[model samples]
Target: MTNRLVKHIQNLLPDFTAGEKDLSPFITTRVVKKDEILLRENEPCDALYFVARGCLYLYYEHHAVKQVIHFALENWWITDYKTFAMKGPAVYSIAAMEDSELIVINRQQYEALLNQYPMVALYFNTIHERAYGAALLKQKTYATTTKEDFYKYFKNTYPDILARIPDPIFASYMQVNLEELVQLKQSGVS
Candidate 1:
């Protein structure tokens, strides 16, 4: 698992390594069952999860309804980063969309890791920037587009992930009602 983690990082960062130092000392692996809640609202978010397989979604529950904010698929990272950094309770919950394998690093090791591995620090910075940029772009696009166009954009942007997510969940993420999402999807917009 550690080797796989190293390989994945190297693929993204190109030659990323800890030299003679092993990453296993700073990381652990866990298997999450589908629908398992990894973190819930008001729970302290103490770690980051790197998806080694399967998918996860981050959402907020309002009036008993789940409004998904984001999805993390294979090779992606997921956590309430602000909460993790602040040592505060999560504003949202994260749940497994499928049985998942995750590489986890808790707050303590994460700080030590950045201090110890410059390359790892740079790698995290790069991914964070990209995610932030993409999120801003998506937010702007979603704000300007119609419900249909928004659905199209999501479908076009994440066809693979789109298929992996359940319709109701994806509908919630799109901020469209289930019936409308069904109509849009079946209306030959794919």
Candidate 2:
């Protein structure tokens, strides 16, 4: 598990090295079953999880309907950043979409590492920038792309996501209804 975590970090930052010792104490591994909620809406989110295996969905409730905001697959990260950073209640719920394994690090430990290690901070900053860029791209795609074009873009961006997650969840992430998603798929738009 430690080796895998190290490898994961290495993939993100090729120059990073904790020398096995520093990295050992920073990680905690857990297994979660399918449909299990890792973090619930309105709960405190004290930790961020790294997916070593399997998939997780981040969702929120609106008008009694759950909407998926993001899906994290293998080698991805999941967290409710507002709750974790501001000490507020979470607006999102993160659930396991499949039997999964994760490595979790609490906010305190993460901040401590950022303060103590420049490389760790640099790596996290890169991660944040990438996430922000992706969000911006999604917003741009939503605003300028036609619905069919949006579906095609999503398919091109995340080819395996449709097979890995349920249609309702995928539709929610795309901000479309299931029927619309079906029609798009049928028309080979996605």
Candidate 3:
């Protein structure tokens, strides 16, 4: 699992090395069962998960209902960033959607690793930039696109997710009504 994690990181930043033995102690591996919550709203998010297998959902509750914000699949990173950065209670909850293998690293250890490995820091910065850009694109999309367009955009952007995730969860993430999603799918729009 550690080798796998190292390989995934190497894919992002070629400077990463598994054989160095320098980063081994900083990471801990865990297997999470489906539906297991890795972090909960209002709780401190002390760690970030690097997914090795399966999927996880990042969600928050609104008016007593859960709203999924994103899904992290293999080779993706998942965490409550607001809480992790601010040292405040988390605004979201993260849970395993399928039995998952993850490399869990505490905030302190992660920071240490970044400082020790400049390439890792650069890689993480790149990821942050991409995530921010995606958020900006989504905002622009919401402002400019119709519901059908939005669905189409989501389908195109996250084609893997469309095939793997259930409709209701996908609808929640897309912020579209289930009926609308059904209509779009049935009409061959998505």
Candidate 4:
């Protein structure tokens, strides 16, 4: 698992120096069962998780309804950035969609790594920027497109998600009801 963690970091940060690789000793792995809640709302998030296998979803409860924010699949990172950075309660909850393996770096360890290896911060910053861009694109797509078009675009953009995610969960993530998602599927949007 340590070797896997090191390899993952090396692949992600191709420019990592020998000293940066030394930080790998601080990363740890966790195996979460299906439906396991990794982070609950109102609880501080201690670590940023990198999904090594399977999937997890990040969501928030709104008027007792769970609204999905995003899904983290293999090689994706999951965390409430605000909560993690500020040491505050999370605004969202994260749960495993299936049995999952994750590599995690807790806040303190991550900070120490950053202090020791400034270049490593660039890797995190780059990924964060990409995530923000994807979120903005999704928001724009949702705002401008009809449900059918959105579904089609989603299918095209995230074929792996279409193949792996359950319909109801995927519908929730798209902010659509199950029936609507079913209708779109049956209508041959994909």
Candidate 5:
């Protein structure tokens, strides 16, 4: 079987390579149903998940409400990095937003791969840098923009993601109300 995760890594850095043979021993591919929790809040989180197909989300419950941190669409990665590094309980829960195929890597495997291949380490460093940049950009965008501007920016920038995610989750991610998102959707604001 073609390993999509391996392919994604190779695409990022064609010079230094990690093939299926190198990663197969350290990874597990799983298919999960929608709403199935991969990592729960306050639970041990040992794996980093890569989305092969379908969608996943990372969120935390606050005052009995779920506040979405981010979504992982196809070719994206999702995990509580704090837990992955510290080997502590997860701060956020990760779950399938759709029936999804995931590539999972435990910490040991993560360490082994990083040690075994310089390219793999570079691959992850690139991923982390991009992730961090995105997080900061999202923060800045949210802080600087008005609600409607934020909504418009999201609609314009991530039409695919906007289309795939459910209303409630999207609202949570946007920190907007569902009715408002509905209105925005119908408002032809884009």
Candidate 6:
């Protein structure tokens, strides 16, 4: 496997020890083809994944409609937090938006690493904190921003993701219908 996992960890924890570096070897890697579901709702979420390449969509389905919560692009870590931590069925499913390279760390190994290195826990905490902050921001955007404003913000923040994801999926992510998305696109709203 490539050392992308180690490089990401080292980037996150610059002061890590040699032993900590060794832990990266145990991180598993997998390839997911586009549209493949990496995780399904109601299944156990034993692992979290770091996106080495391509993208994954995190979503919940309601009335057969996908409600996109997040997009995991390269360098992003993704997992069903409640299920992964508390041991239960996942509330969301993760599917590959494009052929993807992923590095995975199962719950057991993650807990073991935290036990051996408190700072590793801190690193993960920071990751969670940022995710939480983004979620809050997303909520605020939905509540306060106009559709045009939201689209502009999304484009500014995730130009790569916008370029790659399909129109319907991108519309779902924005909580808008396909027609609305097309109208917005046609309007050339920045």
Candidate with top TM-score is: 5
Candidate 6 total steric clashes: 0
Q: What's each prediction's clash count?
A: 0, 0, 0, 0, 0, 0
| TM-score per candidate, chains pooled | 0.95, 0.92, 0.91, 0.92, 0.96, 0.93
lDDT of 3 by residue, 1-190 (tens): 7777777678788766644377787888899999899999999989989888999999998988779888888888889988998989999999998899998999998988877876887777877888778778888997799888988888898888778888878788878778977998998985
Q: Root-mean-square deviation of each candidate, in angstroms?
A: 1.5, 1.6, 1.7, 1.8, 1.2, 1.7
Model 3 spans with C-alpha error above 4 angstroms? 18-20
| Stronger candidate by TM-score (1 vs 5) | 5
Over 1-190, each residue of candidate 6 has an lDDT whose tens digit, in order, gives 3366556656888886545356765477899899999889999999998899989989999999999989888888898988998989999999999999988889887887677767778778878998999999999997799999999888888787799999989999988999999999899888
What residue pairs clash in candidate 5, if any at all?
A: none
Per-residue accuracy of model 5 over 47-154 as CA lDDT, tens digit each: 999999999999999999999988898888889998889999999999899999888889998888777776788888888899999999999999999888888998
Q: Which ranges in model 5 have alpha carbons more than 4 Å from their true place?
A: none
Better of 1 and 3 by TM-score: 1
Model 4: per-residue lDDT, tens digit, 113-149?
7887787788788779989999899999999999889
Error of 5 at 28 (Å): 0.8
lDDT accuracy of residue 110 in candidate 1? 96
Q: lDDT, candidate 2, residue 158? A: 79
Q: Candidate 2 lDDT, tens digit per residue, 1-190? A: 5577678778888988775578656667899999999999999888988888899999999998888878788877889977888988898999999999998988877877677667887777777788878878988998998989988887888788768888888889888899998899999674
Q: How well does model 3 score by local distance difference test? A: 0.85
Local error of candidate 5 at residue 52 (angstroms): 0.4
Worst 10 residues of 4 by lDDT: 17-26
